[model samples]
Target: MSGQLEKIRGLKYIGVVELASQAARILAEIGTTQDRGTVSEMPDERTLRYYLAEGLLSPATEKQGTASVFGYLHLLQLLVVKKLQSEHLPIRKIKELVDGRTERELERLLGLDAKAGAKNEALSYLEKLLTSPSASSPRSQQFNSPAADMMRPVAPAHAARQSAPQQQGQATWARVEIEPGLELHVRGDYAPPTETKGVRRLTRLLLNALEGYRGNMRK
Candidate 1:
């Protein structure tokens, strides 16, 4: 484990200030700051703290004197989250995907992103989509595409299909009926979850809610 982390620690241990600056620079290279990917702003120290609170980023792995220190793995975690944000992935789901991944896995995800292009390009295109709006990613408004975001596969799902949408490109989309009346509309290009996995998760969540509701009623 120590050796693996050591490999992920390309920038070594760094304080918040340096981490923030370097992360910002990387986000720029990946196009997260673009008009399409569109991250609101570069993350500052305060934002880093927020990420810590939210479980989006890992805790500091080391310390430099009185200061907390983070590693490249942390940076990659942030980048992965930012990339998924472009696909409009929810924070909870993003956490499931980013939280436990290895550095090599995270790097592979970054490399797989259409914007990022390939493995060797590594950091090149990661931040692009993070900054730009989803507009640049051609989509069908409401259809399915190959699971390319394939970076993080959504658990699984199976539900009745409920809509038809125009084609935009290879973008993926989904319509999930959470309950009889409530459903989700996933835009294509979102690297949509397959019906089996997507619906399974949504169904599980609904069941959990219903269980609690029933408990309340019994009271």
Candidate 2:
């Protein structure tokens, strides 16, 4: 009907006005700089143009250079190293923090263990792997191959696998799973059981419980 159409049009106009007001308020707070003058006032086309030119309003981009390119885990490791450095912990202490079972476990311990034993274990493994003869060169040692650089130990694949099941199970539980027969009857891909009638019933039950609890508390 014409009346219904007019009501819908009025709603749409109200929504557009609300959105424009919010955007204008946001722009007014964060004043822009332009060629004419610094915008301590409300934004217009000029302020938007200046922001685009300065790359200040550009879309998010990926982090580049050594840290990110090496590995995300390595970047996290570097952050941990920096924190340890600030605390004035020695190299051996820093290594222990990295190799510890947990951060909490390391924080409890005060004494430094034997550094020679740790270094020797690491050196022995590296020596065997590096000195092994390759098909390309009989005399040359493969100490610093590209493959070695890429061979940083990944987190246990099982850890990643365990997280995926828990996340998916949570999503599944939260969703309303309808039977195919009822789904067809509702004429939608998925139909929620919490319809108007169900909601009214739930609201009544909640109100009744609240009133009963209040009466009991007063007594």
Please tell me which predicted candidate would have the highest lDDT against the true structure.
1
Which parts of model 1 are misplaced by more than 4 Å?
Answer: 1-9, 36-38, 112-219
Model 2 misplacement above 4 A: 1-69, 100-219
**Considering summed lDDT, which 10 consecutive residues are worst modelled in model 1?**
155-164
lDDT of 1 by residue, 20-45 (tens): 77777777655656575555557788
lDDT (CA) per prediction:
0.61, 0.34
Flag clash pairs in model 2. none
* Candidate 1: Cα lDDT at 180: 25
Worst 10 residues of 2 by lDDT: 179-188
Cα lDDT tens digits for candidate 2, 10-109: 2211122232343354333333223343223333435433432432222112334421122222222333343454456665556545542332222222
